[model samples]
Target: MKKKILYWGILSAAVLVVIAASYATWNRLDPNYTCARCHEISTACAKWEQSVHADVTCTDCHGTALESFNSMSEKLNMVYKHFTTKKTFEDIHLTEKQSLALANRCAECHQAEQASWMSGAHSTTYKDIFMDVEHNKMERPYWDCFRCHGMFYDGDIDDLMAMEGGPEDWHIKDASQMDKPAITCLACHQVHHEQPRGMNYKDMDETSRGALAQKAKYPSTALYMRADKRHMPADKLLKEQIFAGDSLVAEIKDANTLLCMQCHAPGTNHQLGSEDDKTTIGDFKDMSCITCHDPHSNQLKTSHRNVHKKLFSTLSK
Candidate 1:
């Protein structure tokens, strides 16, 4: 019995030592050292500092592996593993896993953007558009947070362009992570303590700027459908307008359509409007989405609430 107890005690001691060593090494291992040194890329350190993203440390986003960090040899092995991994149908080949990891990291700083984005009309439609239920048959999954937002390192282009081809399903194929560069966090946030322009809707005035703002927010939906020159359901709406020559709505609407409708064109249902009222805006056909909702600070506050059009209803008629 004493012999068995002695043997059990020896095993327990060995396990404790391993645990202590692992914890100590983990606490001491530094991610900047592992990633920057083994990769021999000073930009990882340099850009990281200069970027507004400098506020976040490497490990904060990348998720640390202390065992690998404790040994320079192990760290180098991990780098090799990442480069050597095979491609998959998921996102860009070496990216999907790391992308997922970085998304959790990004949430640390972008919780507010995430909340608003979740509530926005864009997010709601993206789920259906990307899923392709009728065609994919395979029921391909949609991109989660990282597919669009995460940063692609400089050399990852080759991995992205290699995916399968089809216009509707092509972005699904591999893309050079390098080509799909991440718009920096500061692209959306005021990270350097700069005061933001605030809600665009709240800033409108009766001056030219506000008039231009009107043109920007509510662009001509009918003229855009007609100008597509492609056959569409909304083309007839443009014909119903009161002008035989160039209608003022058509002229103004076309200009604003060129700017806002570049991506938000007529064919796709933006899901903001109904079948009858969706494209109808009377004289304000020459506007864009940014007119009503400030791209930067449009929250559901009374300050951002729009009342300009309601006040001008008589003139609109």
Candidate 2:
């Protein structure tokens, strides 16, 4: 009887694994098709389709498979179950904290972007700003991947479904505006199977271009972003436009200014070249914000000072 019971338990566990895997697979497939239909304004999605990541599917970076979804409790309950069930951290089945893993995975397709991200802050030792405690309190903390990847949709479903494309569209002058939740892996990197036909767009020009050219030896995939901090109540400005509310990791910006603000904000302690000395105004203006922060993990810490240093420097600058 005990052997029979053990066999039945093994069968049950196998079934659950299949169910979970199937659920995740389906969830990952559905969003790309749904998002592509609505985001017609920019050719970005069209470009994404050509990228190597086109085959990866969304769930590869984002988490997956709840019987019920888009509920706050989905994430909360999973987190609770992991803690109470006596599973070791390694035994914990999670799709989060896999940025490095995702980078490694993306390397299978997008070698260039993988190379770029690895050389940058995302793969570095400092805790991800999104996961860290120090930097997340600023005005627009929850904008990008910092909130959505591990955690399911905790905000209004209506708002999420309404949006048409990822935050990447926010910077383009002609990009469309729709209420789209974060959807695809290609949303960030232009993954290409064959080498892209032409020269990729870059910011380097004659005068300041020299340093950027030198830095390009390291080759970074991050984009340039800046918040037009010349606006009103700094906190309120961030809340309405970027953050969902109090949670900094929940930073959401459908606007590029918020993206830019991730680095450009007053009192931002970024240095032009030196680690010890922070950048001055002339130096700050010359450098673009995208040089450091990952758009997805905007709230996640990549640099040493955390968001506080970025925020403080924004004010001071």
lDDT of 2 by residue, 1-317 (tens): 99999999999999999987875566656555643443331243454565434554555544453523543355567557655676432342323233234445555644544555555544432123222333333322344432222122233323322223533221212122122222223223323222232323233243443232224222223221112111121122342122112322222232333323433442322223222222223233333334444333433335534543564455545
Candidate 1 accuracy as TM-score = 0.38
Model 2 scores worst on lDDT over the 10 consecutive residues at 224-233
Q: Could you tell me the C-alpha RMSD of candidate 1 in Å?
A: 13.9
Give each model a TM-score. 0.38, 0.28
Off by over 4 Å in 1: 1-32, 66-77, 82-94, 125-127, 131-317
Local distance difference test scores for all models: 0.39, 0.37
Give the TM-score comparing model 2 with the true structure, all chains together. Answer: 0.28
Number of backbone collisions per candidate: 18, 41
Top lDDT prediction, candidate number: 1
